[model samples]
Target: MTEISTLIVDGILAVLLVSVIVVCTIVYRRLGTIKSGQAELRALVDQLNTAVVDAQRSVANLKTSATEIEGRLQIEGKKASAIADELGLITEAGNNLADRIERGLSGATAAKKQQAPAETSASKKQQEEILAALREAR
Candidate 1:
């Protein structure tokens, strides 16, 4: 009876030892997995932070470029307006010159008609021949 009791005690001790080892190994593996997950999460956070910084910088650069383009556009618009004003002035000057030329031509034609009666008939005939020649040249 004493030997049977010893054998039973030994068997229980062996079972308890095996259970403790398995539990310890499982806990160690779980701890390692947790540590690995923490490392991956940290890496993801770092990448997200870097991307945010890069995006902010890009936005700033874009804003600067937009401001520059706006400035250039304003300058060009001013130049275009000045050119349009100059063209308008030139057109007005051309219209004034054309009116002056038309008035001069009409005055010269009236003066020539008034002088025609004072000329001799032979001179008047000669003038008519010259006018016909000029018309044929045109």
Candidate 2:
């Protein structure tokens, strides 16, 4: 009977040891899975950081380009304003010259009519040809 009891106790201890081993194996596998997942998460974070850095750089470049364009536009706007002012002055001068020419031509025509109250038809034809030539030149 004593030998049989000892055999039963040894059997119980062997079963408990196997159970502990199985539980430890399961826990170890879970820890390995968690470690691999952590590595993957770290890689994802690194990629995200790289993308953010690139985005910031791209934004800076765009800002610089915008600034350059703004400067060019300002310069062009000034040039256009100056040209418009010059054109306005030129138009004013042209109008004044045209008024003077009109007055001079009218005065000359009145003087010619006074000088020749009974001009011949050939003389009138010659005068008309001169007027036509002056108009064409203008």
Candidate 3:
């Protein structure tokens, strides 16, 4: 009977040892899975960081281009203003010349009308011919 009791105790110890080994194997497998996922998570974080850095550089480049464009626009605006002022002066000079020509023609017609009655017959005939020629030219 004592020998039988010793065998039963040994069997129980063997069962406990087997259970411990099975639990250890399950824990080791779970840890290996976690390690694999950790590597993938690290790679994803690195990719996100690289994308952020690239975006920052693009923003800086855009800012530089905008500043350059603004400077060019200001320069063009100044040039356009100067051209407009020059055109205004040219227009004023043309108007003044046209007025002078109009006044000169009117004065010449008035002088001719005042002298027509005092002219001799031959001179009056010559003046008429000249007037006719002026009309045709006009």
Best by TM-score: 2
As a TM-score, model 3 comes out at: 0.56
List candidate 2 stretches off by more than 4 Å.
Answer: 1-37, 117-138
Error of 3 at 92 (Å): 1.9
Scanning candidate 1 in windows of ten residues, the lowest lDDT window is 129-138
Better of 1 and 3 by TM-score: 3
Candidate 1 clash figure, as a count: 0
| Model 3, C-alpha of 112: deviation from truth (Å) | 4.4
lDDT of each: 0.82, 0.86, 0.82
lDDT for model 1 comes to 0.82
For all candidates, the clash counts are: 0, 0, 0
Query: Per-residue lDDT of 1-138 in model 3, one digit per residue for the tens?
Result: 899999999999999999999999999999999999999999999999999999999999999999999999999999999999999998788667655655665576568669675646775576557655554543
Which lDDT tens digits does candidate 2 get at residues 32-125? Answer: 9999999999999999999999999999999999999999999999999999999999978876776677677668778988997876778667
Looking at model 1, the pairs that clash are none
lDDT of 2: 0.86
Better of 1 and 2 by lDDT: 2
lDDT of 2 at 55: 100
Clashing pairs in 2: none
TM-score of each: 0.55, 0.58, 0.56
